[model samples]
Target: MLKAVILIGGPQKGTRFRPLSFEVPKPLFPVAGVPMIQHHIEACAQVPGMQEILLIGFYQPDEPLTQFLEAAQQEFNLPVRYLQEFAPLGTGGGLYHFRDQILAGSPEAFFVLNADVCSDFPLSAMLEAHRRQRHPFLLLGTTANRTQSLNYGCIVENPQTHEVLHYVEKPSTFISDIINCGIYLFSPEALKPLRDVFQRNQQDGQLEDSPGLWPGAGTIRLEQDVFSALAGQGQIYVHLTDGIWSQIKSAGSALYASRLYLSRYQDTHPERLAKHTPGGPWIRGNVYIHPTAKVAPSAVLGPNVSIGKGVTVGEGVRLRESIVLHGATLQEHTCVLHSIVGWGSTVGRWARVEVPPVTLTPTIPEPAWTVRASSRTGSCCLLSPSWAAESGSLPRCSS
Candidate 1:
């Protein structure tokens, strides 16, 4: 039997993701109304050999990973387990730390993947190749057309044998466009390299060589140390794929990924706009507009706008690219482009909301505007391009 483990690397607060990851855990962030990690779990569970799944991560100790596992188990009806890491563990460190638990189960091969990613890559196909070749370790590689690949790591694989020849981590000089997809398949033997190194170096009294012996050693990054060292010996293999994949590591990437997933969703399941008069000008995509809501015929909504019960869009209002949680109202002739109008919050008539031109640059795209509220009426004022404290609660609207 084959089992898989997804590493939900703790709260990614240190990165530029900032405020977005502040409220909910990074893995739980919604991508097209579904948690980000769901994409990974759904893909992995469909694989033939995949039986059990373990989600490993360090999160708030109060609830820990239990919440995520419960939802996943109920939704997927699969045998799922959540193992909370006491401390932050690097990729390899997290695997090594959980080595004992994994060995206790004793499966044929285990799959590991990064949680902060979206991809349609055929995981089962890769597993099939691994089983056929009987390789102890396999790394998933995707075409690296972006420059960011240089910062992560680039893999050079023997085309004929499909074995990893060299791993150049954060190379300044360009070579292969095949970049590490932050996914891996490992047999029990993969742990030997790290365990053996630590055991040998510790026995030799070389404290420096065995970082695991130190207090905060669990943070020892795998890509920098373990994988880099193993690549020199050609112990790892690369499987390159040209499938749908995107890294959701930053705020900007998150928005892009959400749009990307929504676009793909449209291709498979085209949007069916409910023929309700109140649901005005609904774009034919995966959008959910409440029947009670009054959207003016002049207003526009779509690709991923979800309005809640009793929400209202005033006449001539233009709201695209946003989620109006519940009872939110866009006042008359207001232009709420690329922004979220919080629940029960009302954008004054003639108010304008476009991406902050200052934050805008010719080089990069703008972040999606998000407004979230519960019970308080929205501040009746014209919102600027960028407002610092944009979220609040409002009372439930009567009409």
Candidate 2:
């Protein structure tokens, strides 16, 4: 049997995702048609002998988390459980804290994945590599450009042997183009290094002049403390992939990820794709429409669009590269592009919402007009280029 653990840091961690994080935890926020981490769970479930999936995080197990856990367990038919920490436990600390639970049933190895990454999780390949060498740590790595590589953990490995020779986390200087994808396969023996880190921290606290000033006992960063320190010891290895991968750090990136996943549906979930039936909505490319949604035949949607439950698309409406959330109505001829229409919101006929392409050029796209997407409870104002230019940000409308 095998297991998987997802390190989803709590609310405090995803501050970069603002209003959306306020609505739902960043990990639970919808990426394609489903919650973000569902992709991770689906990928894990596909692996043979995968028995259980544990979500280690600092969340309080609220209704959303609880409901998600239950739904995931049923959908995947696996024991998907959430392990909460009283406080923020560093990446390695949580693994060490729940070492026994993970090691239970004498499993061969377990996979640890970071919550915020979007990737074509190459789990089976990593498992094959692990079986060949039985290395304590196997990190999934991918190449990024030099400028972007500095933002991630860099790894240097032997060309033929694949042994991790050196490791650095977010170094100021460029070390290597290969960056950690925050996914790992570790054998049962991997817990020993975590225990060592814990013991060393405890000993340092006792020897310090101010014991209280020392780092907490349950604080172990897996990257800096273990991977960096253990490099060149013949324990850690890297498995490189040139597949689809990106970090979902902000809403814009989440949108980009949605596009990526939707594109993958052509092979993975073709039935989920919207088809141009004789009397249905006009479908363009890679679109997902919920069964409950009512879309007029004249409306044009796609090239990456998702219509959620009970959504109503009006006549001659144009929607592209955007998500029309549950119960939202795009009135006749209302054009929406690259924006999220919040849940239960109603867009007026002929209203248009178009967010400028995200870029670093010094120019901001000014909205030409404004549209009010009103929900039964409250209303969210989506402005055209004028107000958007003034605010210097895209506004998210929600109840």
Report the Cα RMSD per candidate: 5.8, 5.2
Error of 2 at 299 (Å): 1.3
Local error of candidate 1 at 198, Å? 4.0
Question: Per-residue lDDT of 1-399 in model 1, one digit per residue for the tens?
Answer: 778888887764335555556556778766655677887788777777667888887776345246777878887778888788887766766777788876666788888888877777568878878878876688888876556566568887788888877777778887578888788888888888767655654566644465645434444455656666777465788877887677776544554566566666655424523332554574545565666877777776665555656888877766655556456777676665444454467765666555432332211545544332212234443333235223442222211
Clashing pairs in 2: 366-385, 367-384, 367-385, 367-386, 368-385
TM-score of 1: 0.77
For this target, which candidate reaches the highest TM-score against the unseen true structure?
2
In candidate 1, residue 92 scores what lDDT? Answer: 67
lDDT of 2 at 222: 96
Give the Cα lDDT of each candidate.
0.65, 0.83
